[model samples]
Target: MSASATTRFGMLHGTALGEGSVSVHQYLGVPFAEPPRRFADPIDWSAPFEGGVRLAMRPGSVCVQPTVTAGDGFQGSEDCLFLNVWAPAPSTVPLPVLFFVHGGDFLSGSGGEYNSSRLAARHRVVVVTTNYRLGALGWARLSEGRANWGLKDQRSALRWVRSNIAAFGGDPRRLCIFGESAGASSVALHLLSPASRGLFGAALMESGSPIATPAGAAEELAADFFRHSGCGEAQRRGGQAVLSCLRAAPIARLWRAASAATAPPPGGGFLDQRTFASVVDGVEVPARPFELVASGALARVALLGGTNTDEGSGFVLPAVKRPLSAAAYTDYISKLTLRLEVPRANLSDVLAVYPPRPAADNANSRGNRAYLYRFDQRARDDTSEPVDWGVTHGSEVPFVFERGSWIDSGNTSFTPAERLLSVAIGGMWAAFASRAQPLPPAAWPAYRNGSEAQLVLSIREDATAPPPFRVEVPPRARECDFWERLQALVRDKEQRVAAS
Candidate 1:
């Protein structure tokens, strides 16, 4: 294989990573769409490069977002719809493709943060990571007429992959879309989106489900934005005036306003005031995602879904300024429900379902092959004050990517046993992408909707041994049932309010 590859766009000179038998052709910062207009859907890149040859070595700018550290302001640019690709070198046959979407609660992450060279070389697959709009630029329904531009950007990237991945030695038909956290939720939204059908053969979501903002909630978010960004008067003037005011505002000011509006209230949980999720716009998103799944309107593709053992600790614990007493826990729940708009009359029922800690196999019932797993392997936190994150949200990502660590700094070196676990998990994921099965049928069976046949990935108690590949029914089945009922109730209340 040469150092350059030609696609419809033009010739791209990439870097060769690794040496000897293990090597990958890595292309960075490849544009898949044109520079986007503020709050508008993405347009696919059709124009060829000016010079015909381009250097695909450096990473592109991140989409405009707030800095990870608070009070640091913003970084990145609006011209940020770039993607990175990694393919095994010296491949004779076209390989499977794994397209990954990153997760940052729809606010602060980039595709560049994940390096896929190892995953591509070891798994013998083509891996691609991409950027999408975030925050006010990506999600906020600044006007009553527009929503889900970020999701549209993702679909545009997928379309680019379908058209050009074959030139990179990837089988276009054998592509899998996977993501973690908000990315996982994005995958769920794509499954329910009509435009995303037939773009990917399989889908995997880690620690997220199909849920969209109701129309009323989206209006509230817009109002918050209007108030914070000083666009309230413009909004009263009309939609066009408000959009012009917002687009002309300083980028930093817009980010600060978005951060302020989206911040949870005092003693609020992660889900409180979550204004960055995909909105239920009648066009792109069509309807509420969970309702679509329940109605069996989801795409007929191979699906895998799971959550970590302690998914909420990372989001909730970091905000805890005091020890949690029973009264404090109840107060936390109250605030959460209030933000979710659950009526006060039903607070007791909500409390009954959620007691400190608790715990969907919707795919199989619709004739789609589906699997579920729980990542119980805990990561070692070598920070000065190492809180027990307990297999927190996103803990499984490094294992899936076979990387030493995903964070900027920490004692993230994997132990011998963890290295082995990483290999196994990565292999399973690649196998699923290659063919709609993660493992041999005898080893891991397809999940049934109402069964206890979930595959649990965890290391032994001592953490010095290989992962015990255990399959069991997830605990707290009754609690899950109660929560499902509560969600339905909440939806009903929202609907009644909307009607009124």
Candidate 2:
């Protein structure tokens, strides 16, 4: 069936489909921002489009980035600023809105990769997903003023949503921004950004926290890009000249250089995945993230965050041989260190902290309440590659979208229980959007500085039923504590050194 809605931009025609219990309005390939110019801010394009019945049945083209798989290379255009919307088909009056940003280390992936039909249809909410600039085109900050085009694009999309989502039966005031991985990082940065305040009321950060890149690192990457893209030859001509030359270069040539320059080795540090990340540019990200949080510079919003049980399994395990020996684990930890030192003590501390089931034992001291959860559902498929792929990074995404069954066959052979789990998780997200609190099966304590209680989502493999779950106590308490202390110590040292 066809579903038509009257938006400020005009009339939009979307496809309608029914799931088990809910009907959904699916609008795809809707432009949210103007086509991007290389290394430039995104411009608003709402006023240009003449109001008419626009068909939004297909996903828009993704942003420019290197082909992740073989046979396809750099397969997108500069004019790839689009978004998709999924609202309840039966027209729920003034439903809460959830705006999503996708994650691919700021280099790859698209908003279209994650479909929110299941979420909107099943939960009776409005879900929007978007595509922004990526890789060098999205990043590559030549100077303070021209950095982070991707972030600018996202903000523009948010502005569009604020102005137009009422047409889709969405409550602009109750909007919540949520994302996983790099997308989650963006959410965190937005929390710290003055530019992003008042855009959304709540945030759900899954496996991502703000880890702003230092100014020097960003500048260094800029220099590397210039050298690699042959823009350094124009060094004497000034920064704007160099930017112009790089923009004029072939997209392929620029992409290859960016790929080669930022690609880190396997088992790399936390900063590796963040090579093309947000920068601490004075305008966008004014200060250290933790400092911003501690100083109460961020908006007062409800936050929910958690990491998978084995966050490193998918990325690090496949590259290593099976039967990961103690030596190999130690070596892997060493390679994962960002600083010159990965002390034996630190290794032992990390090993001690990240066991399958550590207890949660801290209460939060901050004023705003945050809910923390650990996802621990292991796919039942015995033949799944990376024999040790146990709740790795990005693994929880399928569950959140209720698309666990649709993942690559061999990757995740979903059991009936897993599907139930998906329903539970999706419901929690929807409930949070609607009421700022998760529904049943997700009822748990808010995170506190020293609170030991945690909400764990795990399946009962021994139960005869399809999928049975329990809200177990927090896990990995000590490990998280160690990291927290380490971060505090590091922050103190950096501040002291900066003062000096």
Q: Which candidate should be chosen as best, given lDDT against the real structure?
A: 1
Give TM-scores for every candidate, taking all chains together and pairing residue i with residue i: 0.89, 0.88
RMSD of each: 4.3, 4.2
Provide the overall lDDT of each model, using Cα atoms, as 2-decimal numbers.
0.79, 0.73
C-alpha root-mean-square deviation, candidate 1? 4.3
For model 1, residues 214-285, the per-residue Cα lDDT tens digits are: 878887887888778988899898848988888889887888788778877788754365557788777766
Evaluate residue 164 in candidate 1 and report its C-alpha lDDT on the 0 to 100 scale: 95
Worst 10 residues of 2 by lDDT: 355-364
lDDT per residue for candidate 2 within 372-426, as digits (tens), equals 6777776444245647566667777878887654343324355667777777788
Q: What is the lDDT of residue 483 in candidate 1?
A: 66
